[model samples]
Target chain A: MNSNTRPVADPRPAFVENPEQADQQQALGRRIITDGIRTVFLVGCGGSLAAYGPSVYTLDNRVPQLVVQAMNSDEFNYRKPAGLGPTSIVLVGSHTGTTAETVRAIDTAKAAGAESVVSLTSDPESPLATHADLAFTDRPTKWAWDPKEIAMARITQGILDAAGLAASGFDEALAALPADIPNVFADLDPALHRIAEDLATKPVTYALGSGPMEGMARAFAMFYMQEMLWRHAAAYNAGEFLHGPFEMTESQAPYLVLCGEDATRPMTDRALGFLNRYSEHVHVIDSREFRLAGVPDGVRAEIAPIVMSAVTTRLAQHLEAVLDHDLSTRRYMFSVEY
Target chain B: MNSNTRPVADPRPAFVENPEQADQQQALGRRIITDGIRTVFLVGCGGSLAAYGPSVYTLDNRVPQLVVQAMNSDEFNYRKPAGLGPTSIVLVGSHTGTTAETVRAIDTAKAAGAESVVSLTSDPESPLATHADLAFTDRPTKWAWDPKEIAMARITQGILDAAGLAASGFDEALAALPADIPNVFADLDPALHRIAEDLATKPVTYALGSGPMEGMARAFAMFYMQEMLWRHAAAYNAGEFLHGPFEMTESQAPYLVLCGEDATRPMTDRALGFLNRYSEHVHVIDSREFRLAGVPDGVRAEIAPIVMSAVTTRLAQHLEAVLDHDLSTRRYMFSVEY
Candidate 1:
């Protein structure tokens, strides 16, 4: 497939035609979130929950009084920690609402006297939604490059709106995303493609970053690189990169760093400089431009990282596709216990 | 060497015997933290900050007025986000205290008007410590294990004490850790040793858990399996294990899960159950016994997970040693760039 063309397996429908549906869902999510809940608890399992961390951190920092907890439903239902009260608002995210523990969590929260529940899921009719006070459907088609990115973008915006925080910028960002992402990916495609192509034959790979982006680097390196590309890859934070990982770097070894625009930028730059000193195999996705200049005014700079994250990841998906890696074809190595 | 035998290179002597020194350094850290008046930003690179997430979350949730921000210093210094004041506290951590970016972060924080600096380092003479207003030293000789765990325990206690909250039990728990950890590791040594021996030749491994223990599992698996053993490994929360990892769980893959005594026990159990259905090649370090029966009573159950984390990790360390892995052989696969 050509770099600019959509993949043959493009499963997601274009968002242009469904403007009304997106707006309605966004409005509903906002209403549910803004209505009388002093604190918000986002609950999910696995990647779903992992994805919520940045959003939670963003929202929590923006509105210090808004308590955001990323609790795995399985843990909440099983461990039952103290401090939850009737005033707490529970936001549950499960791609498939059929996740048993998530469904049980909603039920448990209601029983425990939670004030409200907001469910984010791909399946509107999933059990969690059925029990939820409000549900935000995340229906991204499988072939939309990175479906989770779009889903998380929407979910994050909805959560922010619900908190009475300004989310129009995020809404605007996502609306322009389909157009912006492809360009960003096109720009970085060559580098990532080279990395991906080389990674295809490598026995191992590492993705390094610092700050909030560490989790992203890890997810991509471990999940995408290993799962999609079937390669051995590891992720490290820029600071920790030197503690022990530097010794593993050599002329033949390749690593990628996600240098997002954050306080960690300088440190990451220095760390990357050190890496470059050791070997020329290091590649970095300089996110400073998108991080500082890309976001529209009035949007919290802290949250800008989220959008920049979207762009970088979009590039990652293109690179993966260029390498002809299929995410669906990979089978999970282990069954989820709960 | 027998499991009971200590390594000749044990670095514990330099730090452990000098509790008063540690206390003095901690006091200095508190002074820097307090004197750095504008904002208190807790900067850490990767696992160092992540290990402190729960505590940061707690502080943010309970004391919103503190102006505490946990970020990777690498991002902070480079991005140069405005609002950093001279009174700001930049708390950075680098085990060796020589991470280039971290050192730069201290410099940037100072330039940004950060008046006081505090650092956690295994090497008291490292640049980060030398430059800091206060520094906590934890000079562990063995690279196989991290002393940050102890530093974090101390830091968390200090935070609690500073906040005037009830922290007596937590303090006691920290004191009891050294003895408890070695004992638990000795008991679980045989099982872990056998598993390590079997997996010595394996190319990849996965560590699974949920809740706070999830981070611990990831840190250990990545450090031991990837760094020490030079084998590939990934860590995932139990709840997410089934999402994409199950496919790799054929009879050939090796998986380890840490089942700590936390609210996630049920989820961990459920995860274990699911993994059992897919494959029998799973190992577990059940930590409930240590939490419930072994820990002293005054410690809060909420903190039990943190206390028992040492035990579980010690087991992992023993396993690596038993498998004839050299704890000091440092491998660098990549360097961090700013």
Candidate 2:
């Protein structure tokens, strides 16, 4: 069993060193501004696309001069938005640089005369990288935070800086982010174990988050719980929870709320409050608990999604241990052709 | 029990006659283009906000010059995107025109110097309407398609017409849409009854859709199943289903696929194909079954969501009957304050 499956008293997150790479991340954003790109499409399949959620949300709020959207790679290719040519930039991601749909999306973007097609992938020789105008490749990591999200943030920072809307201390905070992520696993080990024990045998579990944290919540419920552990799970935007899904509160299903420090935290809190009163199985995985060390308070909320992503990953691992399910076991994913 | 609860041999959907109203719907869209409103914010709470999903998707694909977004009312009020200024327009909705968050959002929009704030609600004297610079109030309808969606469409049409990207026969299609919605109820009753009978006792259910049909899929799972029927349910974008949630296919949970006739239909088909193979509990609710008379084939896919919304609403009533659950029965919605 992996160390993640077995809790240590003084558990330290296993660290995988991200190899030093050329700083090609910011080139996409810089080129976007230089080429007068009016629209930016962040496209990828599954979790690869999810990696850009927070960055897209932040860009939508911070840089109005640039219209930024995160779309599923398959849908983007099929619909092909009217704004996708000449003055547009398409940023896509795939860990192995071999997601077929994403590769097709990049090819289609290039064919449509998009000003730039940028890819973030681990394999420099992969089609996604070779087919794009520019590519940012790094060593693959287990968790999505390091190479993928960090590269996404850097490109985002470039856009904000170019538009004179850069968040103060954002660069330093992001640079220090990877080093601090492990600390979250160590700190939350005890809490995660307890929560996982409670939820292990539950037939269904839910993850909830709002604003920038929504993508991570979905990754936790759908990817980590359902996909990895083969458990029935789902995620909801905390803002929309009360509108419908909260009616299941009396079902006693375990609920985990990713309470980030962003402005949408209150939306999370409201749903949390309702769930807390109505159901006993409620866990709040707040970003405030993370030891981000020197990250400024002003930018703390901005990066909360990254920290919270680590927390969910650890929690999923704990659940795997308690449930005695192998994380890599799947019935149909790579086993069957659709 | 309502006729919806007990399937009629020839189920005719109950129609509430909508009174004739002013043609003020297109005014907002016209002003937006004339005043150079570059950003459009469609804001509302719960299902109110969901009603704008297809319109927003269509606009996003059709109008590159306009940045359009559908945001939860509370989150919109809190984050108040940096783009909310004299060049922006905010369109909000609330059934009773008193959704506190939506009203406050309009107030905040005005305070931020947004070019205009338009309110679409059923109450002309409501705060959401009274606080806005322009109000399009209509008689409330049982289904969201009539007054709410039609008004939303008219404004979208106005924008498209004004921007010179108008879909031919769109106005005629929308005007004729409400009259043909009941035909979907008559056509789908038998299929829905079989599906509901199979799903009535299932502990969990899922609804899947892609692109323009996504919002209705969500409404089916979250609003119809979870809230109204008090069933454990969730909705997923068909495009993203393969990424993670498809792992639950082996569980044999009841699956409902909202197959719209849009470009994204293939994405839904891919998931439906897998689900049909692995899970016996699968139902396909195709929008093509809806007879939208006089609507041209060119715009049929565009209006698929509106038709599917009616189908899901009718199916929910059937579930309510078979499950012996009152659609209005709720433990916390209006009973307790958060």
Candidate 3:
């Protein structure tokens, strides 16, 4: 566990205090089903949308009644979904709630026939939250566990419940998820520091995961490593990595494999074995190693990705510490308009 | 454009001579509609699935009646879709038709109720083709504009046609498409060599596009660069690049932007502008530059991705020449099993 720097804030704490917000969001989700909403567009940009991948996959597989689609903010705003309109629910996800495309997508969604809008963000004051029909806000953190993700899961649960496909007591299980910010570095896991130290100056790095954890692995490599740390890195699905990306692997290039306990563990384990053979710097972050305090075994598989994010959040920060790079450094994000 | 090497064969030449095969596939697609197939699961692994991206996007937005789902072979094999069954069509895509997950996915799809199966591959004797109810075979090509991709497009066209959801005269336009193998080097485009020279030694390269071109862009980066050239690279959607990935776009890093002439052109153009200001190595490949011979304007819009693939296939080969890297060079692909 990391202890030298301030721990990243948990986005879920504010949700515990404002339990009504979840209820309101859940009611909105259920209403969408009851009201005959034809489509639910889970809309956002970059990290916001990538983070919702697991939820989308779950929602698509679990609730087959509703046509669930994830749209990129700019494309959603540029041409927009033809199916969007009064009977469509556009759920806009933006951590800052200030992403220009997502902010515009809310209005665009409505203009395109979005009758119900659910804004998931950290800032209630942001344009998206201010204008949405239901605003699910949590305490803001630039790079941390997305509290709104949990809220989105709850909302999706309500949708499932209304559709008569709820995963027996899934809502209660979701509500019971820990609200406490994790001490990811409290134990100072050697793997975390080892990856950061070894990859401090590596020319390029790769991360891999499968199942719902693919999103978390992507966030770690694309968001935290490339976006925050400005490191040269890439992320691939564990299965696809062997199919094509293995050629790029060598002794110098490191592979950070996120071995989450899920249906795809064997595939990732195979990747790890291959990386271990070919690459000198193979960092493995297995969810089984970390004690996810207060997280029940029932909801653990579904939420393992959320746990992976919290763990990698610390790893990204530790990487910054080793490289002497500030996470706040930016090149044209919020600083300049495209 | 490329004069020194043998021109890559167009995969559709056999289709012209074997017209009855297409009629058989079209009859199958029509039967899918007649039989009331409710869902279409377009399944494949990395490059195979990535290549069908444009067709899928077009089908998704255009053919709203059918639930069109694209699934990874491993994911589909592990947690087969609950919606799969006799009312569903599983279109298995693999260049070699030897992908293990895909082979299992076919049986899983059948077990889950896939009544009609369409196997798209180069080898008719392959496991997927041998087991599938309908196999659409094309002549094989490795690390080039996938021959299977053309076959997949025709099958999708037939599916769209059966549903009466196809664009106006789309089939006529498709039939008129030239069978002439694209001499991507006919014009001897310098940009291909420029991109290869610029990125020959770059530690990391980023590729981006939208719509069907997004898949082509992904294939070029993941399949061509990483898998074929043994180069380190990553690919992302054009619109998403601005939301977070811009942070990694330093002056030194090259950004290969595929600006296709589609609805998403403006979005890619916006990204190109941003990359121009930030990165020195910004390679833009726009489909409008290449005139796909004998293709009508109406079909060109939909078939632009096939054209894009043809154009970039040369770029991949050119990169090999500049880097002196053989396209067949592999660490584990066919040489060893994982």
Return the top candidate by DockQ. 2
Best by TM-score: 2
Q: Per-residue lDDT of B71-180 in model 3, one digit per residue for the tens?
A: 78887776666577777888898888889889888888878877777888878899988988888776543433555656667667777788887666556655554443
Model 2 ranges off by over 4 Å: A1-22, A140-145, B1-22, B140-145
What do the candidate models score in CA lDDT, each in turn? Answer: 0.60, 0.80, 0.74
Separately for all candidates shown, the number of backbone clashes (residues 3 or more apart, or on different chains) is 52, 0, 16
lDDT of 1 by residue, A244-289 (tens): 4555456767777777655455546766877787766777777644
RMSD of each: 6.2, 3.0, 3.6
Q: Which is better, 2 or 3, measured by TM-score? A: 2
On DockQ, the stronger of 2 and 3 is: 2
Model-by-model DockQ, in order = 0.30, 0.75, 0.61
lDDT of 2 by residue, A1-338 (tens): 23334542232233333434324555556667767888899999777888888888898877767888889998899889978999988988988888889999987898889887888888889998898888887754543444677778778777777777777998788777657777777788889988988777688888888998888988888888888887788888887888778887864678988888887888998898888888888988889989988688889988888777667777877877777686778888778898
What is the C-alpha lDDT profile of model 3 across A136-236, one tens digit per residue? 78754433455767777777777877988766646554554454234444554456767788887687888998877777788887788888887877888
The candidates' interface RMSDs, in order, read: 5.3, 1.2, 1.7
Q: After superposition, how far is residue A306 of candidate 3 from its true place, in Å?
A: 1.2
Model 1 Cα lDDT, one tens digit per residue, B1-338: 23443332222221253577557644543553355443557777655665564455344433423445666655566555333556566678877687666888888877867766778777888998898877877665434234565565565555545555534566566565656655655566667666765555466777887776676677666655556655566677787665545545666667787776655667678778877876667887776556233355655444555644554455456645655566556544333333
Best by lDDT: 2
Model 1: DockQ against the native?
0.30
Model 1, total clashes? 52
